[model samples]
Target: MPVSPKIYHGNSTPSPDAELAALIDAHPKPSSLSEYSYGTAGFRYEASLLPCVFVRMGIFAALRSASLGGEEVGAMITASHNAEPDNGMKLADSHGGMLDAAWEEHAVSLANAPDSQHALALIHTLLSQHTSTGDGGNSSKKKLPKMVVHIGRDTRSHSLPLAALVIRASRAMGATVIDHGEVTTPQLHHFVMHANGHMLPSIIPQRCNESGYCEIMAMSYAALLRTGSVGGKGNVGKQRLHSTSTLVIDGACGIGALKINQFQHIFEKLRAEGCTVGLPTLHTVNFPGDGPLNDKCGAEYVQKQQLPPRLYTPSSKGAVSKRYMTSFDGDADRIVFHFEDEAGKFHLLDGDKIAVLVSSFIQDELRCIDPEGKAVKCGVVQTAYANGSSTLYLKNVVKTNVVIAKTGVKFVHAAAHHHFDVGVYFEANGHGTVLFGPKFYDFISAADAKLRGTSRHNRANIALRRLRVLPALVNQSVGDAMSDMMLVDAILFLRGWDLSTWSKLYSDMPSKQAKVKVADRSIITTNENETAAVAPAALQIALQAAMDDMISQESSGNGPKPRCFVRPSGTEDAVRVYAEANTQKGADTLAYEAMMLIYKLCGGVGAPPQPLITNRL
Candidate 1:
């Protein structure tokens, strides 16, 4: 076994052991809660076991801010789409993204410390590494500003108490705290990014506050509508968009309900002044007190079940056939759209669908503005979970570069940012956003200057105008459900398409997903992008056999090939298996085959997984 490397402070002041120890002692970890890991959503667990984790994460955020020379960091208290009793936190870096990967290891170390003194030791080690002592090149010797941390939470009954613990621990580290009470996760991300100087004043031109978020989103949306509306000045504006004036939002009975209400009010105020045309009338359901958060409603439920939320049955007022409907996860960071057919069937328009729609629109607009598709690089980033049909559509139909990343949104975002000038990324579960790189900003600004000097009714000028305001409507720091909803709506409106029309852009292969419990989840691993199993030596071989057998048994016809993969979940103690094929029956059989293989080969713990379907495919 290798020994740990020695830690050095490099002449910094001694650690604040007394304060750290006191803080740690005050928030004691439960005896039964022995191990903790910083999973995709941070240190999540039953609310009762999270107090200690919250306090430690609070201190971690404070130190993280200090490491960035006093730039503000954020800690958002939410377990997006999890049940109400479960809660967690996600740290935002100064630039308004997830915490850096290097620091995630340190967070795990801090959370799993055995005692207060042990926690102090870990804190001291991290503090030394993070806290800078000397100026790099400046001779002026200006002092570093006080450390600051921004905090926000969802509507869970215990979220406020958890927030208090964070505030307490952060204060103990001499960090200033900005408590943004009762806000959506994306709103908090917006606040932290703006507070830390991500203000694109030329593009957004608004104050750095909650109202500023509303103003920027509203103004940009109105600009898109006014530029792309039907019967307007340009040839492009004559499309029959806005078939309906109403949009029903399922807010998951969480903070998104409150924020959507606020956004609707602001949007209507602008519409009344004739600033926008064909903006929808908002109808919000699953508001707080109307139901328990995420209890059979939300993006996760809708996307996974491929059905309407329990509270949003066909008879519900918002369930009008063919009308557009969307669902927000508990904290509103992820969103998925669906509609009830005239025959009362539920259909989901998931992230893959959204990615295709958005990327196609951007590519179309860029073609009009640049004629040659060379000025801007556009691409879509997805995960192994993306439907094979979507990957084909993206590469063949949309004709843009498509790549896969690991399952987390951060990994997908990083891949998108690295690959394209105009990168659009989304998880199959609907957590994602459009990232505009420096090249995109430069191209659009130059195009705007050129177009404004020419005819305003021209197609190039119209597309340029819409592209100019597009960035303002997105939350650049992270995925914001509200922002993405606006993006989908704008694309649908400009194209004059309903959910049915949009869904017709491409067909999805029938797919199935299942989770298998094992004695040790760590024993099951996968290659990068999680497309194939690598560990448990026999796992991949067995899965491949299943896939080959599946293919040979099917009729050779003009259909997509069957595909499947198994990977350990980053956030749970189980392994997830996903499969898709041209037919729903084929998908169910392949998925069930793979599930049984893992259950037997990977030390399955609980009862074996059930049959995926009752009838033969």
Candidate 2:
């Protein structure tokens, strides 16, 4: 017999006591007592340990909304690439990104409260601190701020109860909860950003089958086809491309699989509008049915393991050996590209390769938009974990300004926005997107208008036109798998290169990554860009000494340069160490020694150090 959880659910309206109270009463803190901290990706763990956290997050979410004067905020229920039983929640701001850094501490305090009553008291305190009735602090005359929270969740079993708890807690505080039911992580971001009038005041279609996301993506594809160069061929304008490109997708049997199914009809709509670009045929694998979510599949699995998702069989990989394939994480936010060569060896074109391709495609056009490089500068933003080779190419070959940011998406996104007209940011983990700043749009639009007025069939005119549309193709709010896939397909079509050509742009230096179970991972704070350690500065000295020792031992002077760094894993209870060298053996040795050093100096638990994952591709 099959059974379902009997958690209480509510819509926009708040419900009465019994059911909501019962659910809260049943969920207590974890028996093992893991300290809860709101880190990079929010609090994630086994589902059983997350219910109370969800309940408190809902209250803090309401307070966060109040802080913004009741502008609608978003709560996304997803662990994103974690195991089946693992579930998590992320609070999105009114601006379509993660919770404001300002509110993070308040959220952590609320989540760590002793009980629901204590959590409630904390929420009230937050309200009193930030809430005002136009008259300074008079408690008797103070009125609660009206808040609205837009909530969405991915398709996880634990998500159902957790979502219900969110609704209960939020509505109990008199906040309106617009339940978005099931959606990808990025889709929720799109919806909130759209609903909050951040981008445009358009209504997102209500029915799942009629979602306008496919249409928006199709527009991006159409924009590229109308003006982009393909294999040196001039744009045919409304004429269809003679050849069809195909992409094989690993859906990870999760939310991404369901979303991709809605896109086939989008091409027809574009054709009706007289832009006849051939739509890429999407062959989806691991589309959810009986399989568990993210079970040996998805971007995280492939990236972390340095292998294809277990569900991807050779036959389904690609009929031709030279085809391109990609995978999306559980909620479809991050993506990784993989291809099999003639000899059947797998090659990965991760975030690093993707950055190189994109920066190259736009650099010349961006330079022309502001020739003096005075107001509109184009650049690439990378994390410390980004491959050294990619950084070098962007800085030297592409001749674009390169900036390094902290390890998280929030940090990278900010750097991209403030400094560059065209900001291409990506973590080596395959989480990334391009940011077209305010000046980028103005410059590209002006350049296109001038070019259009001058020449009807010149290459500069076509290039300028395509450059203008590239920004729309990107979902600037956050990293999106669908948006990124379309952008990649467009780049491939423009370059007229198969996966093999794309892979040859630059080879990645061999690198290895491992995790050590530290007694307190938080103690491992980092320097400015997370490239060095802040506390016990000796850690940096040890890391640099190890790299120097390895380089000195290399017999060949032309070997790959040695580099290493260690940082605490924001999402886990372990510290992660990254090392790279010319050869795979050198990389392995460097990572091993680095992990051991951190384990010995810092308080490592259990055995010496355990290797979490390594990728030498």
Candidate 3:
């Protein structure tokens, strides 16, 4: 057996043990809640269990920071897409990106520590394991690195106390801590990315909010400056919005709602500061402080159900299908945009759609930016969750390179970095962003500077300007619904198109997702790409037969364009099945077939899977 290294702060002040002890004691006689395994997000469970997790995470954050030469590690205290009572915490790397995959086990280890004392000991072990004294051996003299941690949270009522626990725990460890109160997940990420470089965030309250808006807005405004309706030159007399141009926002009554309100205030301030383009008039709904968050209204609900949230019922008045509408998840990390048709049909533009459209636009810009045909190639990365038609369209139609990765942002982000001028990644759930490699940004900067003296009147010049500003406008730190909304808006406005026009880009096959309780989800392993299963070897064989059957059933050009796959969920104790077909009936039949087969093989906790059919939107 190996020996444990000495435990002490390397170069910081002494630990605040009294505070740590009191905090550990104050959280209440720790209820012996069910065990929790760190999932795609870090530690998540009911808010009650999160205090203990937060305690361990505080130390984990400090260790992470110290290991990175005292760089500030980011911690966010919001459970995105989960119900209101659920809360989770995840660490950001030194520069405001997702937590490194290699280091995740250490966190999960710390989370699994049986009690405070065990977690405390694990912290020291983590420090020793990660510390390098610029020497070759792990012999002796290793010590804790200096630590700095930054914390932020959403508007969850339960999150505040959890946030406080993180604060106290970090303080107890003698790490430098900064509390940026009540920010969306993206805002926290942006702050981390900005603070890591010369892009320091404003320390002031109102100014911080205003400055944050300006950073993304500055880029967006420049891009849209040529539009007269946006206060530029052409169509100068056109109102900011007509009937369809007006936006109705469903915030999911979460942090996104509050930020939308805050952004509206910042827009006014920006207008006062000589910004020309007007912020679109927004009708905010489902804002936080109004009701339970993510209860029944959010991107998750809209996308999965293929319908608008209950609160978002179409009015009898305006053009129901024409107006643009969007929804954000509980913590504002995911978004799905939709609109109803004149015939009261609903259309969803999910992450797959966003990836295709956004990447295509960027690809077009790259061609024009280097019009000499030097070929600044861009590409897309997606998960198995991406629609099959989307993957095909991207590979064949868009002509951009396409790569598939596992089901998390870190994996996709890494894959996108390997070979592309720009990489766009998104889950079907609407969590994703466009990444511009350093060389790409440098190329854009050079192109913009080269065109500095040219007239901005030409549409080509305007497009180039938008490309230049896009690097800044994109929240490359993470997938931000707000930033993405702005990007989609800019693209639609630039193209002079509406949802109807965008919908015409490609039609989504009718798809369905189902969840089945499983006795041992762990046994349901996935293939490397997570597109198919690895265990119960016969499962794959069965799925193929089901596809063949579905295809045979629809052989005459009306059959299901059958696609089906099943995998165990990382966060929940269930297996998820996905199916898509050219027709609603086909999709339903495919989903039902897949579900029934999985339940038969995988110890499902219900009556045999029943056929679930809904009118496809």
Best by lDDT: 1
Error of 2 at 408 (Å): 1.4
lDDT value for model 2: 0.73
TM-score of every model?
0.92, 0.88, 0.88
lDDT scores of the candidates, listed in order: 0.81, 0.73, 0.72
Q: Pick the candidate with the highest TM-score.
A: 1
Q: Report the C-alpha lDDT of model 3 over 514-559, residue by residue, as the tens digit.
A: 8888888887988988878889788888998988888777663632
> Per-residue lDDT for 393-502 in model 2, tens only?
88778888999998888898889988787889878877888887667666766776677666535666666767766655676678888889888877776656667888
Q: Report the C-alpha displacement of residue 136, candidate 2, in angstroms.
A: 9.6
- What lDDT is reached at residue 615 by model 1? 33
RMSD of each: 6.5, 4.7, 6.3
Give the Cα-based TM-score of candidate 2 against the true structure: 0.88
Error of 1 at 369 (Å): 1.7
How far off is residue 312 in model 1, in Å? 6.7
Alpha-carbon runs more than 4 Å astray in model 2: 1-26, 133-143, 198-210, 229-244, 268-275, 312-322, 368-375, 555-560, 609-617
Better candidate by TM-score, 1 or 3: 1
TM-score of 3: 0.88
Give lDDT: candidate 2, residue 66.
78
